[model samples]
Target: MRRPLRILQATALALCLLTTAAPASASAASSPAPSPPSAAEAGPVLAVPADLAAEEVSFRGGGGLAMRGTVLSPAKAPVEGGPGRPGIVLVHGSGAGVSRTKLREEAVAFARQGLSVLIYDKRSEGYSLFRRSYPQLADDALGAVAALRSRPGVDPAGVGIWGFSEGGWVAPIAASRSADIAFVVLVGANGMPPLRQQTWAVAAGLRKAGVSGSLVERAEPAMYRLIADGGLFPEPYHDPGPTLAAVRQPVLGVWGVHDLLTPPAENPPLVARALEKGGNRRYTFHFFPGADHAAHLSPDGGVTRLPELAPGYADLVGSWVRDVTAGRTPVAGTSGPAPVQDSATVPMGPAARWESAPVQLAALVLFAVAFAAYPLVALVRRLRGRSRRPVTRAARLLAATGAAAVLGLFCYLFYVLTTGAKLAAPGPVAAGRPLIWLALQVLAVTCVAATVLTASAWYRSRGSADPARPGERGERVRLGLLLAGGAVFVPWALYWGLLLP
Candidate 1:
């Protein structure tokens, strides 16, 4: 009976496995093979000028990935016109998936301006049926240039590429490989070494969070290491400096003043420095005030979210393109002035000095409180023995101290937040002097509160005697010491470990 049952169970398991595997195998086997275009399908249908249409094109890119793109052209060249019109390519940033909508809009915008535009889905984005790698993306861009050149109304000699964010890097890398690219526009592009950029980003975030200077200083190394390792601890991603230096094209780098993710302060100077070193005077930079990373989606200062197009970005970009394509020098005032220094200048204001002092004082006070609070509570418990009191004075002291400590922490956080905001705001008065005063106040309040809370918690616990041994204090002194130690060290650890980079 047992043998038969075991055999039956084995048979059921085999059937289940076959059922699950059959569909996947059949699906793979039955998938259709791709077909190629016949000779008759080689050229686009030539409609009249009023009936111009867009067409989809597919080709193989680098690493054997099938790439797809859309090409828009004048249905019929004007009777008196030459063989082709100027061609342009639009490259997308890393966002909620690259789409043809942006490309279509760009193509129509350029087409309206009398230039043919070829906009394609990036590898693995939109309708393209392949995963993308950096090398593959570069190849796709090159392929786009080639596809546009082959179109009937596109002039191979007048080709250019416009890229945003990560696309900025892609455009130049692609342009370097193709001689047909006439020019390039890079929006929110960086020229800094990747490590420096990452460090700056971390520091800016910590500053915004109201972390103090001493803590920031101590934390800087750890933060840099985190960035250097590319969010991992062992290895880094791409190195920006070497990669950027390789491209030798005329570039217009655009950035926003209030961009927190990739601050202009970190990248603009790097670009300017690189240009000076290379003796390449062909680049230009434009910085917009009060704009974030996704500035293109928020042109009118209304919405401040990502992925939305900033107001006036398209117009600004369009103008830049026209000037570059027409061989006109960008007016110096339109693109912001060149960076003055290669590295960020550290400000030595009153805020910096005060921050250092308060942090040192806080650390010392915390240490004292941690060592003294317990002993003081124990002495009081011994003196008040056998009182039969409902609440012991020692326990009351501990509760009061805890409350005060909590209050002090809240006040300190508030002051830091307010001060940081003021410092980062546009029209900066002297924030350093005021910040110093604020830091001192925070230190004083926190010290007093920590002392009071340690005492209060100790007092309150002594009052809660055990039911069997009603008069005895239950090791309240030891617990108070532990709490005090935590209060002293946790904040310092957070500050020194994460904020300074």
Candidate 2:
């Protein structure tokens, strides 16, 4: 009996082990497989044509940002007689974001013409993260140059940076820090101090919109004060001249004759002169006649209807960029054909020229005056009338003032919206009109709401109703006023300013 029992126990233990082990083995086999590698990790380097393939490369920069750019050899395939290609890095202008499409287009154009090109996004723009500081961007650009030098296709000794607008400013600073950068191309750059640049940008914008010479003259001091004090007049003033003069690099400056943002009178030549004064001989300047900023491309590039000017302007830039990269001198003169007779002849009178300045000034002054005077006037009337009336009068006065403010705000917003629409035609005056109008509308609505709510509460407390049960009817009326005011302000402002612009 004991032997039989032992046999059965041993069999049962073996059976239990098999049951548990079988499920475990099956689970191991049935589990999901691991995922494939991501695109960034795989690092698939794109191939160029057989002749151009020698220049193609992928490199990693110091900021932990991987940059992918192309190298273009001077000859088709392997050639015996041709010189090696020079290298150029194309930097983009400021816009909604760093333009990868623009950069690629520029690189390909230069590459086809026998040059190696590296164009990458600024940190926080394009494929990179957003909101990176200027210093970080400069560092990334520096890193790109270092990476290019290590690559097989690039001529480490011959590297340059071609920058536009903000890029122009950044290139000099970066070049100063790195010896690798051999030259710089600055499109629509200015030599004046930054404060002066700011003032000039504003003044030029005004002049383009048809502002009077006298007003511009009068406004200059205030504009200077605004920049000097860092907004409106304050105490210490900051100057930006010395910083600009510190840049030591070969520069090529380009500007548009009708560039309202940085007027020709205030920009290109001025920048060239600054460099010249610094005893820098390696400089070239070019200005496009009758061309608005970024509008003139290849002399025959037609007026583009795109909202942003980057696309229409990219080709001309690519052409010049090709020359710079190929170690050829850039021709400094007008490009593309003149505009059509009708388009070229559109008259820009005085009113159209300086429209931005006066409109902006008027709106600012109105807001300031309204905010300051209304409260003081209301207080004075309340105190003077207190001798003959009950204390409740103060509360009523406050409510009345609040109501008036709301009314004024409604009027201001209405004017901004309607006038903004009227100003939106494709002319000099309307260029910055939309931004100005929107700011004014925001100020008006904010001021009215703040004053009305604060003042009405003060007035209601002064009334002779029960301390705990002050008039619900009056409170509701005031609440209704606030709501009604917003309802009137929003739609009207949008319809006038946005739709019109």
Candidate 3:
């Protein structure tokens, strides 16, 4: 169908920086467009090649869920019961609510190029009211392949899958499951473990949005620990290298230089190495400069896109697929030598490992304990029934500051996950406005002030003739631990990209 190409969803998937231009409404969030048109009719309404026809179809998806699929076919076809034309199945990214309406243009685009295209609603849509899992989504794509093969104009021997973003991970496994998969196209595929990629992207986004490099650097160990300590993924992070290495089909990996969601610096190399090791000489990898995750960039830095797909991108994908089906050597995806790569590019590697996990665990634990120091001291005083002592106003303020910093640290982590992870920025949004970043600043100031006061308290306590409840020795030890906790808070604050100074 000739239609507009537009997708509005959460950009938290953008690799780095905690920034995203917020969407219009909660209804328009990354989930599929709400109240999508049903698989109502049996025919497509969009314009396609004069010799092709379009129709809405449904098939059994993963777990026997009823999935809605749109099939585009050649109007003039080989005789019935004969082998048909090469087919391509378009798999969606992480959009759980992806619908037929959102995919008609893409399906028509490929069909116009003389290939049968099957665009289907993801498993999250119709049947199997279960939470989405990779195994199931891969099964859904495989099911689409089966559904396509069942069609009159689809060639079973020439069928393949093309996926983007999360699809990058799903498509490979679908291809690996059966040798029947003739080829694969991965758009912005991820090379590292899924969670690591996500965390790195979060950190990278923070660094891009005015966060200090030093703070970003210091946060890695704790971020790494978040992964190894579990709760990050349904399973241990999925290392895509092994799965990509197992694919024997002809493959094409497409990426963009400016794709924050999938770092172009890393994904291209990782896919190249894995495909090479798998002995898949049929694999071709292409990188486009100045494009975002979708192979196009917004000049004004807003999501408003150019009417056309990125320069040479649509042609690159269409032409490559045609070549694959035609038994010709696929184009290298560029006329001249590749564009020069960025010098600051970072590669994809394991983020947290067993060796590092222990140290991170200890640091995180002590920090949490340190976070409790203020409370612990108060509780001690309460139980001992100590009368109020004449501590300096500076000491009282400093102690309270220490407690507040601890509380702020806990609040800060929650803030990142709640705001950045689920919503837009890591700040409160009022009247659709993202409040300025102040949480980190508050924590940082508190940490600095706490450090000085704790030290000063320690200095004065050491020389006191009459120590209060804890006495000199006990008071000295408590003060020292408080100082140590404050010291740890400084780095932890920096790690969150809080106060850079």
Candidate 4:
């Protein structure tokens, strides 16, 4: 009973927060760009170098949507009939922006290394917060690849895909489907399912902000599962294992040591193992120090992402692309400083069908009706000039505090999601708990104690009640409803970690 109510509250909270983070836009096509952990977060824009030349172009994406982009190449163009330059198609991680310049830093960096780079606006036709098709996105990426291949200076045989974050997943799918995608590059990629990665990300973000206790250890995991089960988290259960295993292209994986979103230490080994499982031994892994998830400069671990790419990051990509395209595949090995991960990732499979989205929504509706009935009935009796039968003070406290705690928990979690846990400012911390969480826990205990007192009062008065007292039957009815609300409250509180120490 309590589990349903708890999941109900969590599902509601997560749905609202997720919608706010990745709101559905009128445009159907969207790019999965660097958001936080998986993708769909927006990134900062920087100027492309003036020395490089850019060409505006468009191509057909998945479902025949017109995808637009730019091709950046060296100043002295390669002659149309001459040997073409190696090329790369940059895949946006996840976001709504469709400008071709979204990946100016990468395009310019690789172009500077004599590789033509295509950066494009990901389609908006079939993408948003509530829905997306990765295979479709992969098709869109392949479209960009074809466009790059056709460009006068780009070598069709050497064309490849570079995925960052969300793009990491899409790139492999594209590579696996097409032998034309000669190579693959991934930055901040994850080996786990999207749901698991997201669950780990929020917890990691909270822990990085010095948070602990139930919010991180308990509520966060439960909340994410409820969210995914509700179908609000698109592609939450997407397994990248088979996709990576199918990729036969020469692969180069990079991670920033300070990356907070993806588990750097965990993912590389999983990726390497998966690729090796496919009998591909031409993969290389490297780690960059003092960088964030996007390989951007991060002075304070990965809490804040600065606009500038980490030193040697662009150069590494440029040089690696040059070598790999030229058949100089590096020996399969992992290099650079070991990646950092403070905690192991938690598993986040879908919730049981009993705890599915509709059931959770229905449970929430029931809780709302039960809790709201107490005060509404009292107010109506007062308005009708009906003298109310005396009820114990404990009953009133239970009603007030129970409602307040639920509402507060909902709002606080919303704040954490919308503004980010770090920006939500959980206030002072002591004993591994934040002040706000402590207050809610106190309220939860108060509600529980009041329920016991209220029940005791009702039990004592039951036999004393006359069968014909004017409002006795009504008073008993109201008390029963309040008690029922309390029954639901216990499990609800426990589920949200409010009842936990």
TM-score against truth, every candidate: 0.52, 0.51, 0.70, 0.90
The list of candidate 2 runs beyond 4 A from truth reads 1-83, 95-97, 125-132, 192-248, 289-292, 295-501
lDDT of 3 by residue, 300-410 (tens): 332234444556766666788767766875533323224332323333344445324343444445555555665566678879886345344444554565565544544
lDDT (tens digit, per residue) of candidate 2 on 245-341: 5556556666655554444554554565555566665665555554554434323222221233333344444555545555676443433333221
Better by lDDT, candidate 4 or 2: 4
Residue 168 Cα positional deviation in candidate 3, in Å, after optimal superposition: 1.0
Q: Write the per-residue lDDT of candidate 4 for residues 130-231, one digit (tens) a residue.
A: 578899999999888988899887888889899999998999999999999989999999888988887777777777778888988877777667666756
Assess candidate 1 and give its TM-score to the true structure: 0.52
What lDDT score goes with residue 393 in model 2?
40
After superposing candidate 1 on the true structure, give the runs of residues whose Cα lies further than 4 Å from its correct spot. 1-53, 72-83, 95-97, 102-108, 124-133, 198-224, 227-237, 242-244, 288-501
What are the root-mean-square deviations of the candidates from the true structure over C-alphas? 14.2, 20.0, 9.4, 5.6
Q: For candidate 4, give the lDDT.
A: 0.79
Predictions ranked by TM-score, top down?
A: 4, 3, 1, 2
- Displacement of the residue 266 alpha carbon in candidate 4, Å: 1.0
lDDT of 1: 0.51
lDDT, each prediction: 0.51, 0.45, 0.61, 0.79
Winner on TM-score (3 vs 4): 4
Better of 1 and 4 by lDDT: 4
Residue lDDT tens for model 1, 341-423: 22252322122332343343455355446545655655687687733342334333443443344333333323332232213
Worst 10 residues of 3 by lDDT: 1-10
